[model samples]
Target chain A: MEKELKKIEKVISNLELNSQAQIQELLKNFLKTHLKKSKIDNFIGDYPTFIEPVYLNVNVKIGDDVLLGPNVYIGKNTEIKNYVEISNSIIFDNALIGENVKLNNCIIGKNTLLNCENINIDNCVLVGNVKTKEDVYRIMYKFK
Target chain B: MSEKRKQEIQRIKELESINLARDEIRDLVIDTKKEVEKDNDLLAAQINDELNKRGIKSIDIVGAIGAGKTAILEKITEKLSKKYRILVICGDITTRVDADRIEKHNAETVQINTGRECALNAYHINQVIKNKDLFDFDLIFVENVGNLICPSDFKLGTDKRITVVSITEGEWVIEKHPMLFKMSDIAVINKIDLLERLGTNIDKMIKDACGFNPDIKVITTSAKTGENIDTLIEALEL
Candidate 1:
């Protein structure tokens, strides 16, 4: 079992830089090759939420009024405030998102505070602890 | 040796090679910069002599990203384009957005895409000047890449170095990046209009700049409202 786990670790490390589609295909292949049919069926039945579009890898606190779009990754201990809409974005751990904020196609850095109201952010990689209400356009230029 | 021992030896060798490669790259970058600085010193002297002979003026504007460097340039160009034949060289890692904006103000503009370079070296300025007749223009402005650190290290052969810091960048920015202020002839605290909204202490920022460099001329401006722009022009002797 230890040897088999080591083999899986090797595959995962090798596929670290690969595209999402490629990684998913490789993971599926690995699961098919390693797991028994009955075990796979039982695992799928027990954790039926695995097939869902929204994948919550860790414990998150989301408000009831918040709306999340497809392919959202909310990290552990993040507070999604009321009326916030997030889509195609990865919100890192320990972030406090404010009310009525709209984020799309962005990577919210760890320990960030998106406390701006009615702000629309897109294609932005906000650094940790970025406190701003102004329009932050194409912030990737700063990183580069 | 056992299989595990052999694998450990291979891993150590790989790590050593990676460290050696990193050291070599660091050395190469340092040497290249030293050589470039030497070349730049000579080129800058030549550019200065030529500009002095033609009685023309030049200014290099440096600041962090979103610190209102481009906006300040646009405001300055709009005010002086009628009196002086102006030329602006906009430098950035990518995109000609600033160049397009400056061209709209009736200034002859050129865009320098530096690829991965953080600052515009004197070689870039020399090349741009060589292609154009410097005698045709009275004032030249070079809007450097939006970097507070790297741009301070490089001199792009300008008469005045203006560093623009906006209120949006936080108050501690002036104290944090004192080298930029030390090198700059004029330090502009831009986006003063946002002061009430951001609650940034403008007097403290100016005092910090002055404290770092007593000779550095400081101006508080709002490029959006055109506030204290004439004061900036006066400071530049334009």
Candidate 2:
């Protein structure tokens, strides 16, 4: 990661800005370096330019276009879909989540299909191919 | 030639794309691992609260396909419902027929149609359960999506987690899903009538179950033969 970051840094430093497009690439790459370490801000679509870092933010990356409707609470470049509820759910990537789901302490693998709801998952490592018939409510419900 | 430079640039672009992809995946893993660890602690604290409150007498029967979960549910539900005003939550990713099947046994059927997957959390169960008579019923039997691994990970405010496995599946059924077996409060070994024919030793089932959970109550029954049906009923009296 460090080497890759350094290479990207070199590209940012060396890229000749002949047009607005080249300038945009330089800025995006430059921004991604810092953005990688910090939390992303929330927006409907199209991630914003990197400025300041925040704690517990979301980022919607490429291939994650059309993320959560109303796009509440995003990190940096993390892709979510519409119909996904935003209430203390931390999403990773390529996570093909279904509609009207409440996620807490759930680490969904890349490209895993979470096609259900009321899922309270914790202390579990799902390497994709996780299929459920009903909600897996944990001891967390006891607190509520 | 400029062609060589262009090709070099294209190669660099491709490599950069791949690198970006790798970086994104790695960072997500690191961040996710930390987040899940944090969530575990948060959930533990929340669970501690849930347990101290008035826990509903809901039960989640977890097992694999052909483990006779449905049969045990029918047999046990027939009895548990009589005393507890039971409501059966049937989950089968497709069709309400399972709910209908259980309904014939005189229990209100809640068919959770979440495509081809299971509801491994309590929120969805609570969502549908809230619409019904939660307080009126003494027991809400959620027949989980015939999965041992995923169902055990979730604790659905249930008084008991009944794990069903047919003696025909083998004595090693208890060891097949260690996590599920370990999490279960009760282990029902169905098809005990077929034990001799299936060459299953009851002692092995008891030993394996006890190995996972010393407090695990093991009951042997044959839902088809109606053997030990009374015993299953007696166990649920608690």
- For the second chain, the TM-scores of the candidates in order are 0.90, 0.79
What are the per-model DockQ values? Answer: 0.01, 0.02
Error of 2 at B96 (Å): 1.8
Q: Give the least accurate 10-residue stretch of model 1 chain B, judged by summed lDDT.
A: B123-132
Off by over 4 Å in 2: A1-144, B1-24, B30-55
> TM-scores across all candidates?
0.58, 0.55
lDDT per residue (tens digit) for residues A54-80 in model 1: 334345665544545333556567777
Off by over 4 Å in 1: A1-144, B1-9, B17-32
Note the chain A TM-score of all models in turn: 0.56, 0.36
| Top-TM-score structure, candidate number | 1
